[model samples]
Target chain A: MLSRNQIKYIQSLHQKKYRQQHGAFLVEGAKSVQEVFQSDFQIEMLVATEAFYKENTRLTDRQRTPVEIASVADLERIGTLESNNAALAVVRTKENLPLLAGPDEIALILDDIRDPGNLGTILRIADWYGVRKILCSETTADVYNPKVISASKGSFTRVNWWYGDVAQFLSQLGDGVAVYGAFLNGEDVHTLPFGTSGYLVMGNESNGIGPAVEPFVIKRVTIPSYGGAESLNVGIATAVLLDNWRRTGNLT
Target chain B: MLSRNQIKYIQSLHQKKYRQQHGAFLVEGAKSVQEVFQSDFQIEMLVATEAFYKENTRLTDRQRTPVEIASVADLERIGTLESNNAALAVVRTKENLPLLAGPDEIALILDDIRDPGNLGTILRIADWYGVRKILCSETTADVYNPKVISASKGSFTRVNWWYGDVAQFLSQLGDGVAVYGAFLNGEDVHTLPFGTSGYLVMGNESNGIGPAVEPFVIKRVTIPSYGGAESLNVGIATAVLLDNWRRTGNLT
Candidate 1:
């Protein structure tokens, strides 16, 4: 049975302030809960339906922390999802990593990407492309948004994210590293000479790269479109751009 | 003013059966409404706030049919959106295209794509890539889903979609066309030599290419992942594959 106060506390985590105060966030759904449980993040509590306990024995057996079996109604009461099912786990937030850049690593820098789903999908792309770090402007969506977490599917565990003023960070990086931006008209992505170590910048959905970040870019790259789309979705464009860079740069 | 009957009529379009029975569908928001007005599709009704009419003279000016200006609250009453937007236009349903394929054109065939957003985004991609037609299995999400209409943005105006059994269609196509399925362990996308004409089959989000569609594929293509992401979002993956094929295939 879930106490009213417990339910209130769980609901509060939906807000960033409450998450910051408690240093934890909710991970719901059986797959997401399992992923969080297996990750290095610290788990605060695990609540599940009786059926969930019986079905997810592997998840329960592997828990190094305390686990609780609750009724479906209790799980539903605390779950952020519209249709509550299997489980919900409260896990401590991952520590914020200091911004780090090396001379020979491919990186992604997001400039005020406001959509949490797009951000999460980008993180998943970065993970797939083997990008170790994604640097975002402070204005970007919170990486912990439940929508972002759900969209990421599990790639958050492998990709490190750091937030700062991207313009300042790019300016400070040494001369050998390349900075690429996706522009409407630029070098054809197929023909661009992508080096192994560089930063690819994707801007806000509506506006392209902001003026502040524009000055630091070494080359503007674009995927040539033959059709009528005004713009590709930020997430889809990210994947296309990254796939090309890795393929042409032979980063893999 | 929207009567109770009128509001119910608009809301019922949310269902596929109602949309089909009425031979029309709702298109929402300023951009989408403007696109439909500019297209050849017949507009059955136009519902908008006074401010929307003031701001978008182009929408009101382009109308060859009767236009209805309702209060924002009236628009809200008949609108399907959560926040309630400025305009909603009901477009006469597009005529089903004849089931025909050219010997040399790229076509996307969705097996069981359930997400409206993915389907809409894919339609936008097809439009952007100059893919003129998309064939959907009857099991795929209805193209008129509000989420689909929103995600497709304005591309639905240009691309043609047909519904049929994807497996049967693939089996009937001659050897000149390359029927490709996106699979996990298939040939690396970068290494594959692709052709201009054929069916590009994308499968269910979680299960991937269905068993029925799998047997009909003459070739299997895979986007090589360099990192730990188990899979890409179906929509993003579709763009990457389509983009690569257009860039490297005989189409170029």
Candidate 2:
């Protein structure tokens, strides 16, 4: 059962301003909640339905902090979902980290990705491809946005995201770290050196990579399209690039 | 202005039963309505905000039949979106066609894809890749679901989809046509023959390819992971496979 203030607090997180003020955000649904629990992020509060508590006793036993058991109806009242899952949790904001380019690791650099779902999906893609570090333009949607969090589907835990000016970060990268950008016309991904350790950068859905960071790209890669459609979704393009990169053993 | 009955009729198309009964579906938003307007699909009616109708004479000029013009307020009352777009249209459903598979063509076969967004995103991917045909199990989400339509962002006009048993369809295909299924432990996608014309079969988000269709696959492909996560979104996997297939010169 939640008090009026509690409900208001949870609902306030829907907006970025309130989330920033509270220094926390909400994660809903069973799978995401479970993933958050397993992650290092501090779980400020664990709100769960009685049924979820009973079924996930093993998960609860691992909690360093006690979980707050509540009714399904209680969770539903405070949730944004049409049908709230068995659990929801309030997670503290992770510390912001400086964007770091690697000479050996394959990294993903996102330039001005605006959509929350696209950003989240990209994070999940990064997680799947085992690219842990994601450098984002400050204009990119907040990773804690519920839409982004929900779309990431638990991959947020594995991927480290850093928000910074993409242009400045790219210029500072050291030697042997190839910077790859996706463009309409670029070298065929199949022919590019997929085995080398590099930074793969994806751009905005409507606009490709902005001019601010374009000059720093060592190589531009294009996903060859056979159809008449103008472009692929940013998230889809990122996945395609990552898959091709991983496939050819190009990124060391 | 829209009559009460006309508004009710437009709203009824939201339901699958009514959409099927009338053999028409709603295509809203300016770009989608305009795209279908130019396509082969017959336009049943057009409703637009006064500002839109006056400004965009081209779409109205292209209409073979007299288009119904409704006021913004009236359109808003019957619209599905929070803030209605400039225009909306009712389009006749294209006749359901048998799935077409042939030599030297890339195809995508979906097994139990449930999410409207994922299905819609996949359809757009197919359209962008110039994959003309999409085969789906009967359990897949209806293409006309508003969420699916919105997610596809108007690619449905170009992509052809057929619903049937996935296993039966795969079994009937000749040995010369390669059948590739994406899995975690499958052969590395980079080493597989990608450029050749073939069918890429993707499965449900959680469970993956069902057992019934498992044995029919001639090649198993995987998006090799560098991270700790278990899988990529099924839609993302499709884009990855299609892009790699094109990049490898297999499709060209």
Candidate 3:
């Protein structure tokens, strides 16, 4: 049984402010909830169906995660997902600690990717390519947004992201590291000499990279087009560029 | 001004049934509306704000696309987008024509892509890579779906897709053409000897290539993963695989 106040608290985490205030965020759906349990992130609590609780007894026991048995209706009402069969978790949010582009590491820099679904998909892409650290601009969607978490499909557990002023971060690195930014007309990605490691910057959906971050880009890279799309989705572009990097870098 | 019945008729196009009944679908927002005017498809009518009408007079006149000036509220109400400021159109739906895999053209096969957004993104991805034709499984989301049209970001204008039983289509090709299917364990995409022209089949989001379509695939291709992510989003995977195909096929 879920208390009204408890439901209200969980529901509040839907918004960024409430999440910040509570120092927690939601990981909904059975897969995400299960991923949260296995992640390093602290599980504050779980509202789960009895079946889910019973099936994952060892995992719950291992984490010592406090769970309240709830109905599907309770889960659906309190969670952001339209239909959550199994569980919803309240997990602790990670600190916005600074991240660096390690030597021989292909890092990702997201420049104000506003859509949460796109952000989540990018996380999964980053995870697939083994791009360990991501530097997200302040205007980027909140990584903890439920939509982002749900769309990540458990990749959030493996890939780490740091949110901060990307321009300032890029300025800090200066000419010491190569920064490759995706542009409409630039070096053909097919032939670009991608080094062993660099920072790949993807910009906002409508606008390309912000002016502040533009100067830091050592080389503007573009995937040559054969057809008539005005632009590729940010997530798709990221995967294409990263795949090229991995292929050239022999990291694959 | 939009009549209540006119509004009702336009709103009905938001569903597959009404779209089929009327033999037309919707193209919404300024960009898509603009693209539709420039495309080869027949335009049934347009509902635009005074601003949109006066601005794109040439475009609306180019196709002799009949226009009825309306308020932004009318566009928002009749269309699927939450915020559509400029215009929307009731455009003629293309026939379910049989598309053949051309000798030197890269083609896409969608095996039950369900998400309208994913299907839309794939269309955009296909457009970016210059894939001219796509064969969608009947279970795939309707090409005329407003969400698909919206998410496609106007790429629908350039990409030609045929919807029907994909298994029958694949069965028709049987060993005469190279069919590459995305799989968990298969040939490495990086080193795979990809020909200039072939069919790349992307499977359902969750189930992967259906059993019916599996036997028809000549080669199972896989994108090697370096990180902990379980799988790539179908759109991202399609982009990655398409990029490699273009590169290897010398179609770049």
Best by TM-score: 3
Candidate with the larger TM-score of 2 and 3: 3
Return the DockQ of model 1. 0.86
- Give the residue spans of candidate 2 off by over 4 A: A1-8, A54-63, A174-177, A250-252, B54-56, B250-252
In candidate 3, which residue ranges exceed 4 Å CA deviation?
Answer: none
Which docking class does model 3 fall in? Answer: high
- Identify the leading candidate in terms of lDDT: 3
Question: What does candidate 3's lDDT look like per residue over B39-80, in tens digits?
Answer: 898998999999999999988998877789988887788888
As for DockQ, the candidate ahead, 2 or 3, is 3
lDDT (10s digit) by residue, model 1, range A23-140: 8888888777877767777878777887887787786667665667787677767766776678888888877776665766788999999999899899899999899899999999
Model 3 Cα shift for residue A136 (angstroms): 1.4
List, residue by residue over A1-252, the lDDT tens digit for candidate 3: 888899899999999999989899999998888887888999988889999999988887787888799999989999999999999989999888888877888889999899999999999999999998999998999999999999899999988889889988888885669899999989998877799887999999989899999989989999989889988988899999999888877733
**How do all the candidates rank in terms of DockQ, highest first?**
3, 1, 2
Better of 1 and 3 by TM-score: 3
Q: After superposition, how far is residue A106 of candidate 2 from its true place, in Å?
A: 2.3
How does chain B of model 3 score on TM-score?
0.97
Best by DockQ: 3
Fnat per candidate, as a fraction, reads: 0.88, 0.84, 0.99
Better of 2 and 3 by lDDT: 3
Error of 2 at A90 (Å): 2.3
